[model samples]
Target: MHFLTHNTAPCDSTFSPLYSVVFGCILALGLPLNAVSLWTLLRHHSLKSPSAVFMVNLAVSDLLLVVSLPMRVYYYATGTWPLGNLVCNLITMLFHNNIRSSAFFITFISVDRLLAVVYPLRSRHLRTSSNAWKAAALVWLLVLVINIPESMHFSKFLKELNGSSCFPKTPHRSPLHYIQPVLMFSMLAVNMVCTALVSWTLSRRLNDSARVNNKVNVMLIFFLNLVMFIICFLPLSVGILSTNIHVRPLICLASVNCCLDPLLYYFCLDAFWKKKEDVDLPGEQQLKDIRSPCVGLE
Candidate 1:
């Protein structure tokens, strides 16, 4: 619970310590690693490839989320929404947009890799750094547009009822309750489908030994996200129908997402972070040999 979550102030001396510790840990891990990921992708990798370009933007999205966490930390500690409406709106927008962008871009990254492995020659034409940038820009623009209604929907002040500041105190008759779940689940479904397709394509390309290793590593990341997406989202999406408006379950699930998110990101694209020089395994020697000609062309 946050210190300043309105409706009911999220400030129990008992729980505040736990919340502080969690956010502090996330701030520590997300900032440095996201910074390094940003640098490695920008300066150390071949951005000529779309996957590399998308990876750079993905790191950027995560870093943006990381940057905003401190505000939440402050809010949790002080138990105040002192930032006002404008800052709160920007914070909300940034958080949601980053979330949408991350999920979509992960799918895009998977597709990029699948395309490269499945149809190298044809895919090469469509995969360029500049084009990747355009796609990334489009994602931000679209997600921002999708989230615009949210900014309008949220209220910074309640009518003396001591309600939540970040969320509106509008009547239950308002449409946002339905709209929010629909939007979230739609995005989730799109991501799941895209990931499945990519996984299938990639699996087809892997030889027996490579297949086993890839399944172990890649599925570890993918399925964890899939599982969490289901369990965490169930309350936010499905519990709307239930009369019990218990926010604690949803809050707990949401925190799980944040805590596990770093691990998911680490493994999902960790292979790309490895430079050409990092390998010693004989299994991947075949891949290097196959790509040596393309490497030389660079």
Candidate 2:
């Protein structure tokens, strides 16, 4: 328990209030958003497609992370960890696992879109719902394998006069920490490639107004995914390697992604935002008919 004796006053003073408020906001917004996203995805039979499968998994990851925020909110608001070490470890692991898993699922969504747009005919066999599920399972397995050790390594409780802290700054380093940034960058690279290819493919079809519009919409989704990837995960990746940067803010920033992910669900699944009546009426069915060219490709 010698590691617990180290002074963590600076971290507590800087992060406690900030984390409390930030995490509270995330919980309030993210919980409902992700819950609705999951409900919408599952309700509409959207899981039939590979992209929808990835979206469903992504929503699940966000929900898992969001559900754990209340514990974090209490800890940061009160600056104490009365939940015990086991719960603290679980929470830490959930945070790490979900963030990276969200990235992986987002990358998968981009790649799915890329294949649908850029290599629709050739990549047909690769873009099945079964493959998506298998890929999602692999992502979870890989993330758990990578993060379990790292979470355990860094989740040292800090003893305070009042109580113990769940997550305190530790001077120790782990190889998994280094690997995290590499994995994030590699996923980022994949998103970039997908975005570029999709854009080029769309550019060639600009002569067809309707087709080009649909492809542009598809391209925008990938662009948003790339932007979100850079905004949410890039800072943490950079902070991992740099000594001067505080990771608390980066983590908080990343938490916002849980709220933003529902937007992807809205755009990717046409039925997500549609009302029951709107979906059923023949007059209003034109909305569904304007499907993306990449719709059935996945």
Candidate 3:
């Protein structure tokens, strides 16, 4: 596993220009879009819907992740982690939290959709925003608690050794390595299960045109989530599989997620998608009314 050869070393970027560009794009674009999305989801929309509440939190988590990427940019440009040890722990926690929380929120959204379609009558009570926020709150608390070890156990530069090369300086804390794998597997597992449910419900709903809009939204969101899941965790998974064996960073492709996530936000700006329109009508007047700055979707 990568943990053994990892040697708690700092990674010097031979790919600085590449990663710098990528991280910069994410920082410049993802942060603002995610923040606006969060604001729209919170103040502008009625959080009484479980789905909306979760979406709001999802935006918040994504924003947190976006905000943290700048540090990565700085590291890439400087080729050293000048931020000190405490920042290392915070950055690790923030990155993992954003990824895990996003996965769970997507899974929750998929399941909520499935129930609304598969069991409409039962959904009224179960899908209330109050309950949705409660469930999302519980997930947030659990994710925070679970990642505490990664945050606290995190070790940075021993200073005396590998001063420039930063890594998981887990001093006598080998248990920390397990944290990444555990979180990765847990997220992938949950996403798989929830995605299956989303597929099943969407299949049934496909027969009815009235449901197609929501279906499209869910499908797009699901696909977006699946992509994010793969990108965010696959490298970590590969590193774990090869036992972190590869000489180079396993997943350089993950850099695309920054642009991709923002595209999802632009997708949200679509009137049909945001309002969950039953019909895809082409009326500038109607679309404009719904598309106008977020105002608690009815």
Model 1 over residues 162-198: C-alpha lDDT tens digits?
4334322222212444665665677567656656655
lDDT (Cα, 0-100) at 40 in candidate 2: 72
Residue-wise C-alpha lDDT for candidate 2, range 1-298, written one tens digit per residue = 4335333543544337678998999999999999887887677664667877888899999999998999888877765577776777788778878878999998888888777666665676787888999999999989878876676565543223233556654323567777777888899899888878867766664457765676667666776777677888877766767766657777888888898888776664555544232221122232334355334322
Residue pairs clashing in model 1 are: 3-76
lDDT of 1 at 90: 75
> TM-score of each candidate?
0.70, 0.82, 0.71
Best by TM-score: 2
Q: What is the lDDT of residue 34 in candidate 3?
A: 75
Give the lDDT ranking, best first: 2, 3, 1
User: Candidate 2 local accuracy as lDDT?
Assistant: 0.72
Ranking by TM-score: 2, 3, 1
Clashing pairs in 3: 1-243, 2-243, 2-244, 10-165, 10-166, 48-129, 50-129, 239-244
Worst 10 residues of 2 by lDDT: 275-284
Residue ranges of candidate 3 with Cα displaced over 4 Å = 1-15, 156-219, 244-298
CA shift of 213, model 3, Å = 5.9
